[model samples]
Target: MRSRHPLRIAAAALLAFATALPLAATAQAAQPTAAAGGVLYKKINSGVSPSWYTPEFERRLLASGTDGVRLPADATLPGGVTAPQAAGLVQPGIRPGQWLLTLLGSDGSDNLLGWCSANFVFKKNSTWGLGTAGHCGVVGQPVSAYVVPPPASGKLPGLYVIGKISLSRDHGIGDDFAMITISPEFSSWMNPTMPVWGGPAGVHTGDQVGEPLKHFGHGTLIGTGGTPRVGAALRWDIENGAGYSWAGAATPGDSGSGVLTLSGQAAGDLTHIVADVEGNMIGVAGTRMTKILQVAQGWTLVNGSLLPL
Candidate 1:
């Protein structure tokens, strides 16, 4: 007979070992899988928290090795990514509901990843933070105030290094939201509600079916009504726990925005848009902010406390 191939023999032995191993051992050997494109991706059992939840965010703050927790408030391209100096848009005073933007990818080939609205602002001890959809920016990514876009380039001004992202997770794909600690320099602009869009009525939880809903982003309002569909849309092996809008829908660049009831209670954050036609999109999807905060153990709302569901 021909000499047995070494590779075949090795494969046979490995298969035998695997077959003989106890089932529990095999299960224990499994690890969380990573996502593509290096956005700190992972897949977990449905409804379970992502790997970078409470502990990871806490550890990140400590890793900074600073007297106080902070993020880059001004533009300084990482990894030597070159872009034009940002033209200043921030003025003497800043307030909630104002637009914010993030530059995605390296400087020269940068994309206007996000041109969204700030949902809320919060403070803990002396630290200030802002809340937006997790999909807008990842943890430790730089953020800046909004400027006009499409070929979104040149030295945009009002350039201040916003604080680094402390915590963020995407809906469906991972966890669906993020919170950025505000740099003290920009803290003056912070507020609890979107005054420009509606009111400072404050945020609350649970579905507001038959209640009117409004989203403030892209410097305008998108309205929705009819019985809100609770937990209607799920994707990427994760349940959105989102209340779907029957009327208006969100489009690109609306991620991380809050879908607020007219009374000012935060219903959820815009995670994805289901359908669209000629500036009219339907079936807007978002993750419940209350549920997000419940899982976000170390985080609280801008009221300096967590809201009840």
Candidate 2:
């Protein structure tokens, strides 16, 4: 496997995503474009520096339960193992958001992978859902939000393995991504919660590579402090075409967070894998408020303003 930085992952993914959109969606797509990074909270430790690595490296970011970032400039992930194979396998803690979700049964039991988590779309009537990496949520399985915590908290921040998970018809492995459909029941759990502190982070789209953007989320599972919508925020002009910031990319635990820009504008949600942060890359952004509208059971313009989904 070839190694990749998070930035490269985001860029490469976009290339594939554009090429593989469902025929219906592809018809609506504007065209292939360029982009860059920035995300929520702190970056996850991942234990490995390179967000993406080669199978031959063997120096994975985790020891078990989900370790390692997968990427390379020209090769697919999990294809490298050159790292000190044995030494790179250290167990990392499972935090929601970044942890890959898995489901075992539909008994409504917490049978999903402890490492999985989700970023849901809160809605009324409890019919909310979210979009996540395709590999995690598939046809007939449950989605995992957070692994069983150390038991110290007795509570995790994501959904439990209670029901079925649905993916977007556009999902693709060759694209290395997926969209997750959740239930409104899962939205209730994240009520009155914004995950990180500061302000009501929002999401916006139709942005140019040079347009300004901001992000917010827990620094990966590594435990880091979050920054408010203040200070000299990084610009979204680093990569190409149109891009976000690299330093602000989300970490392991920030999978489903939103990426809103200042001025209460929706830039895009921290949806997919943002690129170029710590290690190989960082931010892996996906859809923002615009897409959120697609799955949002309902919508309301709070204070005459569209809230970031």
Candidate 2's residue-wise lDDT over 243-299, tens digit each? 334223343434344444445454434423333222233324444444445543354
Query: How many steric overlaps does candidate 2 have?
Result: 75
- Please state every model's RMSD to the true fold in angstroms: 19.5, 14.1
* Off by more than 4 A, model 1: 1-95, 109-112, 147-159, 219-246, 276-281, 303-309
Model 2 spans with C-alpha error above 4 angstroms: 1-100, 104-117, 124-126, 146-159, 169-193, 197-203, 206-247, 251-253, 263-266, 271-284, 291-309
CA shift of 160, model 2, Å = 2.7
lDDT of 1 by residue, 200-253 (tens): 345555443444555555322121111111222222222444334323333333
Of candidate 2, the 10-residue stretch with the lowest lDDT total is 87-96
TM-score, structure 2 vs. true: 0.42
